[model samples]
Target chain A: MKILIVGGGKVIYFLCRTFVSKGYIVTVINRDHDECVRLSRRLKVTVVHGDGSDPQILEEAGAFTANAILAITPNDEDNLVICQLADLQFHIPRTLALVNDPDNEEVFRQLGIKTALSTTYILSSLIEQRASFDEITNLIPVGEGKVNVMELLLNENSPVVGQTLRDIAMPENSLVAVILRDDETIVPRGATVLQSADRLIVMTLPENYSQVLKKLTGESE
Target chain B: MSSDLRYFVIIVGCGRLGSYIANKLSHSGHSVVVIDSRESAFNALSSEYSGFRLEGDATEFDVLKQAKTDQADVLIATTHEDNVNVMVAQVAKKLFHVPRVMARVFDLKREKVYHHLGIETVSPTLIAGDVFLESITTSPIAKREGIGL
Candidate 1:
C-alpha cells in the first residue's frame, strides 16, 4: 500500500520504517526541513518538507494518489485538517488520525475519520489493569474475548496449590498458556501440578473471567 | 436547556479516565451516566450516583439509546481505543446532538486534527505539564482556566 504519513516526529519515523520493512511505498510530510532531509536519507521513502495541512503542500506530496493518509502530527488541528483534505477533498480510500486528546476522538469520528489512536487511553488501560489485580499479574488481550492471556501469582491461599492440572476443575475455554516460576517459564501439561509460588499464565474467555479469578486465587467473588 | 434544575452528563468508555471524570462530575452534583463495552470496568463504581450503567459497544446506536445519550447535556468519551472513542463521541454530538462533547487524547500531537474536526479535547500530558509548571510559579487565575478544575 502506498501510505502517506503527515508527521516527522519519532512516531512517524517508526511508522515509516515499519511500512518500508513491509515493502510498502511510504511517504512522509513534515514542516521541519532538517527532519525531512534526515528521514528521506535514513529511510528510502519520499519526504516532503512543508506544512501538512496546507493544500499546496499536500498536493505536492501526492496526497491524492496514496492508498491511505495517516495524520500523526503532534498538533491535533493539523492532523484533523490533513485528514479532512485527504478524506473529504481528495477522497482517499482510508484516512487515519492520531488523537492526542481522548475528548476530541468523537469530533474526528463525527468528521468521518475511520481510525484514531489515543495514547492516554492506551496507557490508562494498562495502568487500570495493573491496579485491578493482586495475584493476576499481567493481563494482555490476545484477541477480544476469544483469548485473554494473564499472568497469575499463586500465593499461599491459592486453590490450585498442590493440585495437578488434571485434578482442577478448569472452566471451559480456559487453558494454561504458560507457567513462570523462579524466573523460568514452562509449558504445562496434565501432569504439571502447581506449587505455592508458581506463576501461571492462563488464557480464558471474558465470560469466565470471575470464575478463573476465583479458581486461581480461591477468593470469593 | 430544560428548567428542571438538573444537569445530565453521559460518559462513554467507563475506563479509568472515564470513571474518574464521571465520579468528579457526579460528586459535583451533576446527573451522570457511564457506559462501556465491558461490564467489568464499571464494577468498581459506587451505586449511590443517580446514573445508569450499560454494557455494550459505544459505537452502536442501540447501545447509545440504552444509555440515554439523547438527554445528556454533555457526552464524554475516554475509551482507550481511539477509534471507538471518536465514533461514540461523534454519534453523541452529531446524531444525538448532545450540547457538549469532550474526548481524552494520549498523543500530544493530535490536538490540531481534533480541533479542526470541531471536537473539544482534554490532554492529560499537557494538563500535567501545566500543573507542574504552576507548582513552582504563582499564577492563581491561570489555574482556574485549566478545564473547570
Candidate 2:
C-alpha cells in the first residue's frame, strides 16, 4: 500500500517509521524546507517540500497513486483542503485528517473525509473504555486531559434522534445543557425529543464522558 | 439599487483586499459584518465604513454562528490564504446555506477546484496579469496618466 502524508511532526515521524517497517511505500509532504531535508535524510520515505494543498505539489508527491492520504496539518482548514484535494481531485481511495480542533472533526466528516482523528475526542473515548470496568474512569482522569464541555452534532442517521430524553440512557455524570437547532438554543428537558442536525452542548464528567458520547452518537462507533 | 435593497453581507478576513471590499460594501448601504482573527486587521477599514467587526477565526463554526452567517444574503471570503477562503466559502455555502458565496483565490488553478465545488471565485493573479498587460501595451503617453481606464 502506498501512503501519502501531508505535514510532518512527531506523528508523521512515528507513522513513517511504522509504515516503512510494514513494507508500505510512504511519501511525506512538508512545508518547512529544513524539516523536509531532515525527514528525507533520516527516514527511508520520500519527502516533498511544498504547500501540500496545491495540486501541483500533491501531484509531484504522487498523490494520485496513493492508497491513502493523511492530512495532519495543525490548521483544521489546511487539513480539510489537503483531504479535499486528495479525495476529489486525485480520487485517493481513503482520506484521513488529524483535526486539532474537536469541533472540526464532524465538519471534516461531513465534507467527505473517510477518517478524522481528534486527540481530545480520542482521549475521552479511551478513558471511557478503561473506566467502563469501574463504571466511570473519569473520576481518576480518563486519559491525559480533562474535557468538561463539548459540542456534538446529531446526524440524521442517529438512532437516538427523535427519542425523548427520558427514554435514553444518559450517563450519570453528563448533562445535555443546550441544544442548538436552526439558530435556536433549546433548554432541553426529560420530555424533549432529540432531532437530527441538532448541536448539543454537553457538560460531562471525565469518568462518564465516553458512555454519554456513545449514547448520543452511536453511529461513530 | 433602491435604499431598501441593502444586502446582509458577511465578509471573512480583513486583509488588503478584504478591507477594500468591506469598505465599498458598507458605503453602498449594505449590512456588512467583517471577521478577522487578529483585532489589528480591523483597523484597515476606512473611517466612512460602518460595518460590524468580529474578532475571531472565520472558518470556525462558532465564529460563523456568532457573525450570524446563516442570515447572510451573501458571503465574501478574502483571507490572504486561498485554503482558508475556500474552507470558509464551503462552510457558508454548504453548512449555513448562504445564498451566494465567493472567495478570492491567489492561485488560478486552485480557483478551478473551488468552482467545481460550486463556489464563485475571483483570482487576483489572473486579474493582475490582465492589468499588467494592459498597462504595458498602452502608449508611452498614457503611462503619464494615472490608470488605463
Candidate 3:
C-alpha cells in the first residue's frame, strides 16, 4: 500500500518509520526544510519540502498514486484542506485528518472528510472511562466506536460468579468471547461455568456496554 | 433604500481587503460582522463603518457560528493566507449554507480548485499579472500625436 503523509513533527518521523518497516511505500510532505532533511536522513521514504496544504506540493509528493492520505498538521484548517484536496482532486481511497479541536470532529465528517480522529477526545474519554470503571481492565473501540472489545475482570462481588454461562443473561449483541482462568485459556460455551477471578474477553455493541458491565459486576452505572 | 433589500454580510479576516469591504458594505446600509484573530486588526475599520467587530480566529467553527453565518446573505473570506481563505469559505458554503461565498486566494492555480468546489474566488495575483502583461504588450495609443516631438 502506498501512503501519503502531510505535515511534519515528531509524529511524522514515527509514522514514517513504522509504515516503512511494515513494507508500505510512504511519502511525506513538510514545510520545514530542516525537518524534511532530518526525516529523509532517518527514514526510507520520499520527502517533499513545502506547504502540505498546497496542491502543487501534494502533487509533488505523489498524492495521485497514494492509496491513503494522512493529514496531521498542527493546524486543523490546514489538515482539513489537505484531506479535502486528497479526496476531491486525487481521488484517494482513504483520507484521514487529525482534528485538533474535539468539536470539529463532527464538522469534518459533515464536510465529507473520512476518519477524522481527535486525539483529545479519545484521550479524555479513555481517562473518564478508566476512572469510572475499575473492573474493566481494557476497553478498545472498534468499527468507528459502534462496537467495543472489553476485558472484564470478575471477582466474588460479581453477580454472575456462581452462575453457569447458560444461566447468565448477557445483553443483546454481547457475548463472552473468551475466559482466562489461572493457567487455562478457554473459549466460553453455554455449558461453561462462570467463576470468580476469571478474566472475560467480552465483545459488545457500544450501546450494550453498560448493560453488560451491570450484568457482570451487579452494579449499575 | 428599503430595509428588506439590506444584506447580512459576514467578513472573515480584517485585513486591508476585508476591512475595506466591511466598511463599504456597512456604509451601504448592510448589516456586517467582521472577524479577526488579532484585536488590533479591527483598527483598520473606519469610524464611519457601523458594524460588529468580532475578535477570534475565523477558521474556528464556533467563531463563525457566533457570527451567525447561517443567517448571512454573503460570506467573504479575505484572510491573507490562501489556505485559511479556502477553508473558511468552504465551511460557510457547505456547513452554514450561506447564499453567497467568496474568498481571496493569492495562488492563481488554486482559483480553479475553489471554482470547482462552487465557491467564488478573486485572485489578486492573477489580476495583477494580467494588468502587468497588458501594460508591456499594449503600446500607448498616440491619441493626440506626441506634443513634445
State each model's TM-score restricted to chain B.
Answer: 0.78, 0.86, 0.87
Ranking by DockQ: 3, 2, 1
State in Å the error of residue B33, model 3. Answer: 0.7
Q: Write the per-residue lDDT of candidate 2 for residues A1-221, one digit (tens) a residue.
A: 99999987888999999999999999999999999999999999999999999999999999878999989888889999898888888999999888877777777777777687787777766565444332222322222235566667788767789999899888786888888899898999999999998888887775666678678877322
Top candidate by lDDT:
3
In model 3, what are the clashing residue pairs, if there are any? none
**What number of clashing residue pairs does each candidate have, in the order they appear?**
25, 2, 0
lDDT at residue A206 of model 2 (Cα atoms)? 59
After TM-score superposition, what is the CA distance of residue A91 in candidate 2 from its true location, in Å? 1.3
Q: Of models 1 and 3, which has the larger DockQ?
A: 3
Error of 3 at B117 (Å): 1.8
Which DockQ-derived CAPRI band holds candidate 3?
Answer: medium
Q: Which lDDT tens digits does candidate 1 get at residues A1-221?
A: 88889886787888888999999998889888899889988988999888777667777888778899989877565676678778766778999888777655655666667776666655665566556567777776543224667888999878789999989989888988888889878998898889988888888886787688888888855
Error of 3 at A110 (Å): 2.0
User: What are the per-candidate TM-scores when only chain A is compared?
Assistant: 0.67, 0.60, 0.84
Pick out the ten consecutive residues of candidate 1 chain A with the lowest summed lDDT: A139-148
